[model samples]
Target: MREFKTENIEVAYADNTIIKNLSIKIPIGKITTIIGPNGCGKSTLLKAIGRIMKTKNGAIYLDGKNIYELSSKDFARQLAILPQSPIAPEGLTARELVSYGRYAHQKGFGKPSEKDKEIVKWALEVTNLSELSEISVDNMSGGQRQRVWIAMALAQQTDMILLDEPTTYLDVAYQLEVLELLENLNKEHGCTIVMVLHDINMASRYADYLIALKNGNIVGTGTPKEVITKEMLREVYHIEADIMIEERTKKPTCISYRLNNRKIAVEAGIKKGIKVVG
Candidate 1:
């Protein structure tokens, strides 16, 4: 497993900063979820951590060494990233696509070794895609194709894995299946898993730690039981909600009950018993 530390990191595009002096430590061997509203720099921060974005300032350290100093191949060996909305080449079979993950581990003019094949096989099995290994990627459903992409990342066998919105475009059942697979990876192989999640309930249920962001800054960081309070929800998301504890899992579940502006104005009018034409 690997520990990542971002210090005073900043990213900008065309004079508009997307991330500003943000810093956070991704815990090793645990699931860390980054959650925020749309355009809140969640995806930008994930890209910065994976060295996919050009940052204007600050540094990111992986396993106590500067990530920018490593060669591309060496960095790929240590880290693997699955970005949001990845494109796949047409007509590639599931097995063929997963085999590409061994590129970083092979020598000049070398084919996939026994160990590489084993890793790829295990990844396909874990993702429940072993039955479709020979099927073309273009012929699969969206959820099935997503699992294949995740299997490719797992085949890389890196110490750290960064996934941006991994559950996007998936049905409710498939979403839970993917998250369960990730949880199993962390628990069994002790890999560091950092992902950007849109569903707050899933983030709280699956992650060991949570990081809430707003306007490129961190608003809260802690375990779900500690960080997902009513006050933090109101401040970070601008919503009034109640926190409920699940009896089986004992995790905090948020239930938002705030009225919209129009509803609030209507309530006020009713309180005064005034009826007027619009």
Candidate 2:
């Protein structure tokens, strides 16, 4: 597993800086999540960690060595990234797409080795895509296609995997399935996982470490129990809520209260006399 460290990292698009002097460490063999509102640089930070974005400042280190110094093949061999949105090639079977992950491991002038095939098999099996291996990706449902993409990343056999909003198009059941698969990967194979998650409750349930960001800055970093507080929800999400401890698991559960009509009217910039209801 790889331990990732970012120091004074910054990214800008035109005049707006999406990430500013952000430094964070992703602990090895654990699921670390980046949580924030839209356009708060969480995805940018993921791209930087994955080396998909070129940064003008700071450095990202993997296993105590500078990741930028690694060659493309060597880097791909050690790290695999699943971007926020990945499009599948038309008419490509799931197995064929997963086989592309072996590109980094294949030697020049040779076919895929036995070990490569084994890795591909295990990846497909782990993701429960073995049955659909021969199916074309274009015909699959959104959740199935997402699993295929994740299978490709797993087929790479890298110790560190970076995923940006992996559950974007998935239903609730599929979302839990993906998260459980990731948890299994971390627990069974000791893979290091770093992901940008939009759902705070899911992030709290799945991630071992949480990093909250706002306006290109880190607002908090700690375990879910330590970092997810009533104040944090209000500060990061601009919502008022009460935090309670779940009886069974003892995790923090946030309960948001609906604002009264009077407060809602003022917040919505509507006249007091206007009555609106479903």
Error of 2 at 269 (Å): 15
Question: What are the models' TM-scores?
Answer: 0.90, 0.90
Q: Model 2: runs farther than 4 Å from truth?
A: 257-278
In model 1, which residue pairs have backbone atoms overlapping below 3 Å?
none
Locate the minimum summed-lDDT window of 10 residues in model 2: 258-267
Candidate 1 achieves a global lDDT of: 0.87
Evaluated against the true structure, the overall lDDT of model 2 is: 0.85
Give the CA lDDT, 0 to 100, for residue 270 in model 2. 48
lDDT for each residue of candidate 1 in 1-278, tens digit (9 for 90 to 100): 44689999999877999998988998888899999888889999999999999789998998788888998889888889999978889999999999888888889879889999999999899889999999999999877888888889888888888999989998998898889988988898888889999998999999999999988999999899988887777666666777898888788987654634554455458789965335
What would the C-alpha RMSD of candidate 1 be, to one decimal place? 5.6
- In candidate 2, the residue pairs with backbone N, CA or C atoms under 3 Å apart (3 or more residues apart, or in different chains) clash, namely none
In the range 1-278, model 2's lDDT, one tens digit per residue, is: 44679999888877778987889888888899999989899998888889898777888888888888998888998889999879987899998899888988888858888898898888899889999999999999877888888889888889888999999988999898888989898998898889999998889888899999988899999998988987777667766677777777566767554334544454355444565555
- The 10-residue segment of model 1 with minimum total lDDT is 259-268
